[model samples]
Target chain A: MTLPLLQVRDLKVHFQVRAGGIFFANYLPLKAVDGLSFDLAAGETLGIVGESGCGKSTLGRAILQLLPATSGSVAWLGKDLTALDRAELKAHRRHMQIVFQDPLASLDPRMTAGDIIAEPLRNYETGLSSAAIKARVREMMEQVGLLPSMVNRYPHEFSGGQCQRIGIARAMILKPKLVVCDEPVSALDVSIRAQVINLLMDFQRALNISMLFISHDLSVVRHISRRVMVLYLGKVMELADRDAIYGAPRHPYTQALISAVPIPDPEKERAKPRVLVAGDLPSPLDPPSGCVFRTRCPKATNICALTVPVLESAGVGHEVACHHWRD
Target chain B: MSASVLDLKNLSVRFATPEGEVAAVSELSLSVGKGECLGIVGESGSGKSQTFLAAMGLLARNGRAVGEAIFGGINLAAADENTLNRLRGNKLAMIFQDPMTSLTPHMKVGHQLTEVLVRHRNLKFPAARDRAIAMLRRVQISEPERRFEMYPHELSGGLRQRVMIAMALMCGPELIIADEPTTALDVTVQAQILDLIRRAKEELGTAVILITHDLGVVAGMADRVGVMYAGRIVELGEVHQIFNAPQHPYTKGLLACTPRLDDATASALVTIPGQPPDLQQLPTGCAYHPRCGNVMERCRAAAPPLMSTGGGGLKACFLENFGSVQAGTVVP
Candidate 1:
């Protein structure tokens, strides 16, 4: 079988945060990403679904090597990225790019849209003429549904949607094989969200790019992803094909998440059974023993509290990390 | 329909900017019956929040509100500061999107909760504290006694929102205006918050005005919905009618554009072309005409008034039989 374009094996990102007052302050390892393993085939979209503080964003950054992983490996094109030095990692960055959540904040306020998009080309292709870069930037502007005339406009001059287009243009200008989209459309208006999603999908199709789509919105994830991974407090609760994860979620966390999404249709929304899991997400610094999700999980037993549940094969291409998933 | 707890009659809000006067809300008219939830859905700068802000007399320095927002026979638009101050915490309450910013950071959460009761309900500090803690428990906040002493920063986002709800519920206000209450929250936490709001309406018979951009939240919580665009209500109808048989092109486009959890066909999400109109310089005629799929010459020439749709719905569209023409074409 052909090697996957991106392979993440037992990836963990732990941060040392200080606890207590200044005098008696002690450090604690915040397990943002404990252990996550996944493989992305060429041009495949792997959607990571989770709530805030679930470490989905940390996993995305760790994979991109933007944030250094505490341990484990992220292999891109059969080459280990963790071992790469700064200069070596920079050489491989052109093949991978990230689209941030906040559109306006991500773009440099001082830089014009044209300059922002052209910076990538200027960095990689030092020999390219200024005119050539301008022409390519303009082309990308049109591709991302931005007006070519607005290339000279500052990020503030553009609306939220237009600013996001500029951000997309900048990311896709490198023709990256893999893109880590971290809640790309969360900041956009509802009417503008679809436009951005469509633009990403089109680019993914035309360029045959693998995408690590990270979002808390399950509906948007279900739309874009072929495979889905559900995360809770830095651990994978379930991972499977989009249909299997959404249609027949085995893990109780996945089931609750799916049920929590309010359907737009009033009739169907009222009819659907709600699995409202009680309480907020537990702190990752001091996570519960054994299964991390047992505090809020409905099916928690003595065994769940005593021993951690490893991801086991539930069905073809499906893995669940729950002791009582079968029940 | 039951008696309206809050009635807005031809309300309009305008802000004087350096560039020009921006019409934030234009001649909007709607009413929320006692114990009923009315949702106002719109994109940014669509004046959904401003509509309620105008009613609450909470407009900024340069902003001016016209027409009448009658709440319990008091014209809120014309109400004096002293009169409004008396009515605000006692009869009317507002829950903002960000509880962190909305709530006073320096004060204890319990003080914030008790302040409403002490000022409006004329309860002593000890008695108000008791009621505040009880309200916290009622909203399903665990360890209510311990949580009461904690400051806002000590609480999580969901807990802060729950505290906001508890504060709103302290005086048993007649109307609760929740503007994007669950926008900052995660989906799982959002469900719990929405459920709490639902309970307040059902149990206390409190009129609720849920203002949000999320149609999914509106579908579950709102009894009726008002689709706002370019500072005007494009469509206003029952949640079922609005979803099942949308009469306006804008409503149809919005419903189509939003991604659905149930729909997993791997098809492209339909998008409404063009950006939302600038409030300062709105397009001639229908503000949505520039992006409308079925735009006609008349739509560009003159705006259509919000007319009744025979099925107890109001639509501001000139198109005849929109549901029939757009049938079997929308992505399910």
Candidate 2:
């Protein structure tokens, strides 16, 4: 009976790259987001997994309209975000927020933590008093496990994990319904990475915030997401529940990815047969036609090259873009 | 014993700063056996790299190396450039984290590989070229002869890394120290590289000192594991002993932090609080005391020496033995 929190239909984000800089003027479109579609339910976390340059990050930014959407529509709640004016998009910014991959770059060094959290609320709510804004900043910090004393501290004073917490506080300050978390813990040390992961989970549960968590780390994705979508060369390779995806991944690439994760067990390491993916990922600019993964897919057949495979159910609630599935 | 290819006994590495001497590696003793792959597992600033650098005589000009370093029965701790040069590369070599920086961009890939052989082994052009191309194939790079002509820029990240390994392994060194060799590589490439390193070690019977943060890689690659934290070897033992039952708190925390392939969800990552202590301003007692949850009264004032646990692995924690096989602190 309830509508999906976010709906994306045939989203395609392509960049026109001039062959020899701007002077050559030869326009060649880079297929960064070649036909991609997935839905995020309210309070549900959808994990996007892929290697770098797979357009996973681009997909997140495109959904936020942080970058220009070359084609397709992204409807959030009831509003068609793709059709909104610049002013209207800014008005809706508070509802859909993003936590960036790099905490250092995302946060301003000149501004204190309190000011960074207050900036979002002030832009959205003009009638609020200064004292009320400070009170709310303190409240958000406490909600995210930060002491009230840390409010006035500079970004540099905080560790990578703490700076990330500040980033979280800023994202949650406005009470956004949906948040796009882009590799939130990649920069952190392993010990600190876990703490930040826990913090994010606690914040998500408290707010019931829907999120599009994009990361190269599969383990992190498996922990946070209910539904997992595997991306390869700017296209969705497989989509299913997290358990089905991590437990019994149908795609060969997903299987390879799952196997590649180093388990800290000596016996497991020696016993496991590593699925080695030979050769480099194909450049997005010259992505192979038909199935995007055909170049690297071990199961690639003639049908895989002749036509594109649509997202069809290979199993119950499991959609895979491969003709090779179930064969 | 193979006479212990390389040994760093009571080795201490420090950098002279405007403030004072900051000890990066303190009273550390380590040795690699011939053909044995000893993994140095630690978070950053664990003095993993510093120990190898101090042993290999590769410390920067500003850095100082102290204590005993006997490689091939030769004292290298006090060796001059000429003395170190007499043994560098041909007998002992190292591969670093970044591959692109290791190989010269101006030279062709083959030229770079051949130059190392020529410089270290004093081989002629023709002999070096043939051996270099052979080394390329040994590292599993396809079209070795053709890739030989290609410049570093033309190759991929994986290829550049392979070239770095090939260069290091060419002269049949008795010991190879790889500092996070595959950190920059992708998972598939990382696995390939790991397999390649193992094969190379088996073929050459060369001892390998591998330093890495990824426990999975360490588990898969290492025969013996040494966990370094705050410039000390907090835990050291056979791979099975360390993985099955990590005695040190730092080691246990690291294993828990790794996202398990079988963990139900990806979100429940274990987090150790605070950062590694500033090397110069470390706690008086245990370096890990501040972040330690099982902090004992003695741990607050007196640093626990690296003591052998009742079990197979050695530990430096005051608690003696603790921690379950739980994946992490909490399950989400």
Top-scoring candidate (DockQ): 1
Q: What is the per-residue lDDT of model 2 for residues B79-132, given as tens digits with 9 covering 90 to 100?
A: 988878867777888899998887888999888888767887789999999998
Pick out the ten consecutive residues of candidate 1 chain B with the lowest summed lDDT.
B323-332
Interface RMSD for each predicted structure = 1.6, 2.1
The local lDDT score (0 to 100) that residue A230 gets in candidate 2 is 90
Which stretches in model 2 have alpha-carbon errors above 4 Å?
A21-23, B265-270, B321-332
For model 2, how does the per-residue alpha-carbon lDDT over A1-327 read when each residue is reduced to its tens digit? 788889998999999987766665777899888888878898999999998778899999999998888888898886779899999898888888888878888899999989998899899988899999989999988877678898889999887777888899999888889999999988887887887788878878888999899998887888888899999888889999988998778888888888888887899888998787777777777788898888877888899898998889878889988887886
- Model 1 stretches with alpha carbons more than 4 Å out: B324-332
Clashes of 2: 9
Clashing pairs in 1: none
Model 1, span B119-203: residue lDDT tens: 8988999999999988999999999999999999999999999999998888899999999999999999999999999999999
Candidate 2 interface RMS = 2.1
